[model samples]
Target: MSTPSATPATPAARQSLTMVCATMAGAIPMMTLVLWFVLAVDGIGEFPESWPLLVVLAAAVGAYSICELVGFRTPPLQYSNRPTAEVQADSWRRFTASTFTRFAVCEAVFLISVTLAFVADSFWVVLLGAVIALPLFFWEAWPGERNQRRFAAALESGGIPSYLTGRAQD
Candidate 1:
């Protein structure tokens, strides 16, 4: 495994991945907000338990932490040593899949809160979920430079070429 040296990504690759991240980041919040609005207006029903709120908040934090620690780390596979285009493609697939999984987990936290809002007839639950999830969505799911570098380093350590992650050798 090679250590990834920090380098600028190719402009085209950077733009393409950036577009992917942008679209995903935009679509997720949009979907979550739309669902929340529909339920807030017409779907909430009163339920008398508040414990679920704490449970949901705890679950959100736990889930995000687990995903952060585990999802981004891909082990070196036998095929990773090949250094072929197929390897690059596989690396890209893994990277994108991990990205989507992280995003989905974050979105799930908010969606769960939204569901709780409908069940408990409490908008505060939704707000709490957003408070936990939105910052994570930005810090982890948004394909900012820091995240791009992190993923690049991970992939590089797993034997993928840095170019696939829009990085060059130092």
Candidate 2:
């Protein structure tokens, strides 16, 4: 019987992944613009407001940290006795899902900051949140070569390959 051959992920799939990363990164600038517009129209209204807003900001940051920590530590896809292609596809799917989740968390934090800025009319507060969140977003959501290799290795039978040295398996 002829065995099914494994193949690298298609170019289209890679492009789609790239687009997803780009979209996630774009959230930062988008939020910044929205904040600016709101501030320009409304002006900074008040400062040293209630403790609840501060609590919400802290909670948002904490939630973001937790999501990033969990996403990095956990493998979205577990090894299974299955066809190579199936495993590869599943691995990529999991990688995408995890990445999206992380990005969403980052986006949520940004949105919350913007909302707080709008409601409190305090630029400094949102700026502080953005300062904290932007780095976390870049660190956690930016998909680099290392991330690609990690995702690819998850599809390997042994799951020991930390990096792909050559053409990816089909």
Candidate 3:
């Protein structure tokens, strides 16, 4: 018994969701690129260009996100009050779990980019990857709910409609 007004998502919301998914899809590589570049610089031995590790990294990230979207599950990051409005403990658990997961994943992705870039010998990929990951880490790493504000801005602006310009409603 949900009213239209009570619906969790609207058409505008759906558009936002789609943009988010796409952006998440794109973000992975950017985060890892810098590390890959650093690895490539030292000739340490990750050996990626021949192996095209960047391509594979892209695929892995894309796959992870596609799975999340298709399964309709919450991200291991982000806090929500759905578990228990009544208990203080459960709320804390959810909060810890969300942050822990995001931190681990962000670190892992950055490390993986470095590892792959070292092995692949692709400095460009590594550098770009690290660059992207660093900001995303910060974006997710705020002390409190600060990221939400940025997330809202990203969703709203990235999907700016072509028809919403040059006129006002009567």
Candidate 4:
């Protein structure tokens, strides 16, 4: 697809898709955080034997938060109020940043949560939560390598043409 960074002269379709993906990048993490909290509250497993899983959980969640924060704070996306393609590009950049920063933040949050659970003896919630949640996380995150290709193909196919045609009327 024609990513905004594909080249400045890239078709508006590519740029537009890039923007949508970027916005998605920011949006997903916010949702993940909510789900993570829910899972934490529910207790899928214990943190003692499940430290590794907790780490994974925290990292994934943090990635989402970091991505959202970065996207929300993005220079370009925040630059204008139009809510269009350029915003997408800027927002996508946050998603990219999330790919790295998310791990750190997620880990930190998990550790804190685990500690709090332990100190407060809120064991069942976190332990059971981890047990039930890990598999789901793996499966949910598994589309790792396929995301970009799938999105690119989705965009390159017919999205742009339709969008442009619709926009032309305005």
Candidate 5:
């Protein structure tokens, strides 16, 4: 097993990660706003009452909570005796997959709430959902420098081949 290092992610990797974060940060809010606008223009026609809305809201919250808990606690990336670059690439792919899963959960919450609003013809329901989901989105999807560093640390600790680390193979 390779020893952990304090080394940060490579520049290109860092930039790509930053771009992913930025894109997610922008896209989620825009999606919520678009949904809100659509709801407003289309108007709430008719559907069930508060009970259905509450249920959906609860489910959304539950899903978000589960995703957050799972995503952060578990490192999806696996360690192997491969070239450093190849290992890094595999780790990045796993990280992206995990991140996207969290993103989807957030998106689902907003979309479900918006759909509920459309069905129930209640702007308040949509508003409530968006308000609830927005924070979750920011919390889970907003990748910052800290996150990048943590990911790098995790990768280091996960054990790369000694050859990659310029150490003699055991």
Candidate 6:
């Protein structure tokens, strides 16, 4: 027994959401650049401690794989029997929540990389981490119109009506 909100998501809300995601996604590359600059100017001289950086790199690879699984796929809940409005609201809620989670995880990847680069006095860590992360940041984390369409279609196929998918009206 769920009561759907009478007011659906407004276009303004959709635009705001997209902008927020895009802004955060855009920041990642800039942060990577900053790391590169720091390493270029006053890099810590190389140390023989390679084991710790290797361990962190391995963890980063694992984290990237997990992030991919968690970021893009929505939980397949049975909402076909529910009212379209209720289903739409639920879908919207899930989509928005997951978008933020994906963004956070992606940011974590960059953070881990940048932090390791500083600790290890190596620029390569940031580069490798950015390589693993930037694709997903642009592809999955950014809530562009294309992503919205895909998400809406996925939900529609799962039993939510196309109209009730809460996409921003053109």
Candidate lDDT (C-alpha), each: 0.67, 0.61, 0.43, 0.40, 0.61, 0.66
- The better candidate by lDDT, 1 or 2, is 1
> Which digits, one per residue and each the tens of the lDDT, describe model 3 over residues 40-134?
44653434454545554674475345423331223222334433222223323433444445545554555665666556566654554555555
lDDT by residue for model 2 (86-165), tens:
55555556667767777778667766776777667776556656666677777776665565555555445354332231
Best by lDDT: 1
Candidate number that wins on lDDT, 3 or 4: 3
Cα lDDT, model 5, residue 128: 70
Q: What 10-residue stretch in candidate 2 is worst by lDDT? A: 160-169
Separate clash counts for every candidate = 0, 4, 30, 18, 1, 0
Q: Which residue segments of model 5 deviate by more than 4 Å?
A: 1-10, 41-49, 73-80, 145-170
Off by over 4 Å in 6: 1-10, 42-64, 73-90, 153-158, 162-170
User: Residue by residue across 1-170, what tens digits does model 6's lDDT show?
Assistant: 99988865555546777788778777877887877778755563344266645755676566667656655566454645777556656766777887788777766777787788877777777776777677766766667666666666555665535442354333
**TM-score of candidate 2 to 2 decimals:** 0.65
The TM-score of predicted model 6 comes to 0.63
Q: Which residues of candidate 1, in runs, are more than 4 Å off? A: 1-14, 28-50, 77-88, 158-160, 168-170
Instruction: Report the Cα lDDT for residue 56, model 4.
Output: 45
How would the candidate models be sorted by TM-score, starting from the highest?
1, 2, 5, 6, 3, 4
lDDT for 57 (candidate 1)? 80
lDDT of 5 at 10: 51
| Model 1 C-alpha lDDT per residue in residues 53-105, reported as the tens digit of each score | 88678778877787789857876434335555566566566666777778887
Which runs in model 2 stand beyond 4 Å of their true positions? 1-11, 41-57, 73-81, 149-170
Instruction: Indicate the residue-level lDDT of 35 in model 1.
Output: 61
By summed lDDT, the worst window of 10 consecutive residues in model 3 runs over: 161-170
